[model samples]
Target: MSEETKQPVMIFHVSSEKGLNEIKKGKLRGVHFFAETCTQYLSLNSSLLNQSDIKEAAKWICSPPVRDKSDSEALWYGIEGKVLDLVSSDHAPYSFDEKGKFFMGNNPSFKEIPNGMPGLHWRLPIILNKVLRKQCNLDLHDFIRITSTMPAKIYGLYPKKGEIRIGSDADITIWNKDKKVILTDEMVVDGSKYNPYSGFELFCWPDEVLLRGHTIVKNNKIMGKQNIGKFLPTKLSDYI
Candidate 1:
């Protein structure tokens, strides 16, 4: 598969020094690291399992489980050094009950927990807020590049979707740095009844969002009709 594909193989939840070394090796051979691997490693430490309540610890349980608490700084340095390519949520949402399945048995184990958490809505805000608070070295331009431009280019959406040029699609997110949002279950538009980011207070949020020149979100509320998103087809050449 590697020889035939000739495309970057994306790795997930890389949090160890060994993993970082592997990512560096993979990049030379066309490999990329998913952003969540870096962000979650820095944000949620393995110590949380011991420090917080069971429910809180359960919320942080995802694949490639959060690494040793000591590795956070090194992982952040990896992102800063451009060892990581793009950011993604992996946006998988499982209900609270499904996540609790690990604890249902007499002997609870991390292995029984579901493998994902909801972050579709929180991805942008959390990263941007981090930048705002000076927690990371990223600037606004870097944020846009990692979150939008790079992903579009990677998937062949390029000039059509990533840019704000005259002929490009008007897909846009208007952020208000001054606006604050307290993330809670009620604000989640996804079907999940619980959000892993619930109670997070974000300093910046999207005030409006447009899709193909149509207003889809206004005042942070979804206004577009369901099933309005168009599918995009990408060619392997686009990846190159």
Candidate 2:
């Protein structure tokens, strides 16, 4: 149908190697399909679930549960080859209490556990470290594409939300590559207090943040006025 009408199909939070292979096959057939994967697929794996500690395993109870290392490498290849159009956090904010992931039981079934954990704050740091360390085989350019530019373009936020050209929103982040951060669960907010990516050591992080030309953050400090955000309507991009 996509090939017939030249319409695009977006597959969200993609995590399977077989699925990506099929998407590649469809692309070869002239299908306009874009796939987006999250940090879990690219940086994390299912091995954490093998632990005897259900408390630890519970942190990874996400939909399309994190897969093996081979699958993760495949997803990275997909991003590098442009077979994947975007990367996302899929930041579902389910708490660890009985009101959320633990609602069904003290040790709930995977079926009963809500499929999400807090990782939004760690997504960039984790990937940046791997990319900089030559672990992911992706350059800084690829990192920016998957994390910012491509996502903005594909989701119709380009020019304004993605790039740094004239007339675009002055949204920019200055990185301090020399700065290092030891990951901890305390860094997360707007969700549970646990971070599945805790213990990761990142060699860089945003030192300054600007939104629409306003300085919002500097060196982990909040300096901007609150509630300045606006909703944006989108046109699914034809970039793919």
Candidate 3:
């Protein structure tokens, strides 16, 4: 990762294409590579930098900062071409007070501030709502491959953990494509009150979520106990 410099301020734009090119040329070493590009980068662009008026928006702010429309195009192409493996939230929640103090002009330096934002809930929806909806030629399998199958395969969580088939755990999410609602703080705040998608309309949401063999979420509310979530053991040998 490279930092933005004020003097020249030129960003080293490394698209997935260039990275793969370097690897193919033997300039970089690694037998295989897996990369995760987040929701904020997928849906947002440089327009967000000018949205400093909205303090909460800055909460999700990241550096190697959001690029222009061109970069968005490159990222979309990367996703479509199967260069990017998984889409995750990189979920983090910070209070307005915590984020507000940095931009107060006291420090006046981008490096001094803490970097992160909240989006545990909205990550999946944004992908489905924005990227998938606009993809004209992408099939359903391609969609599932990027979001679910690839992640499981790369991390060795496949067939046994992520897929839906006989003998596999019945983990699944039934999304209601007809459901439409304008997002607001009143409705969703997993651990924080602000959402970047606040006031944005969503056409779909998960109507049901099954964890393993049990129904945990029904009609967007928890149907089972919260503490039942368990951690899985990691075996590095299986993958390496």
Best lDDT among the predictions, by candidate number: 2
> Poorest 10 consecutive residues of model 2 by lDDT?
187-196
Per-residue CA lDDT of model 1 for 24-109, tens digit only, reads: 67666754323335456666667756744565677777777777856766666666776765777767676666434344653456
Query: Who is ahead in TM-score, 1 or 3?
Result: 1
TM-score list, all predictions: 0.83, 0.92, 0.77
Clash counts for all predictions: 0, 0, 0
| RMSD (Cα, Å) of model 3 | 6.8
> Which residue window of length 10 is worst by lDDT in model 3?
2-11
Please write out the lDDT profile of model 2 over residues 205-230, one tens digit for every residue. 88998888899988788898978988
Q: Report clash pairs, candidate 2.
A: none
Q: After superposing candidate 2, which stretches have Cα over 4 Å from the reference? A: 236-240
Candidate 1, superposed: residue stretches over 4 Å from native? 1-7, 25-39, 51-53, 98-108
Q: Pick the candidate with the highest TM-score.
A: 2
The Cα local distance difference test for each model comes to 0.72, 0.83, 0.61
Cα lDDT of model 3 by residue, 1-240, tens digit: 211221211112233445434433332333344555676766667776675454534555664455666666666666666555567776667555644425455434455455666777887776776644664335567667767876676666767666898877678888887788687776664655667667778787788988887998898778888688677654542432
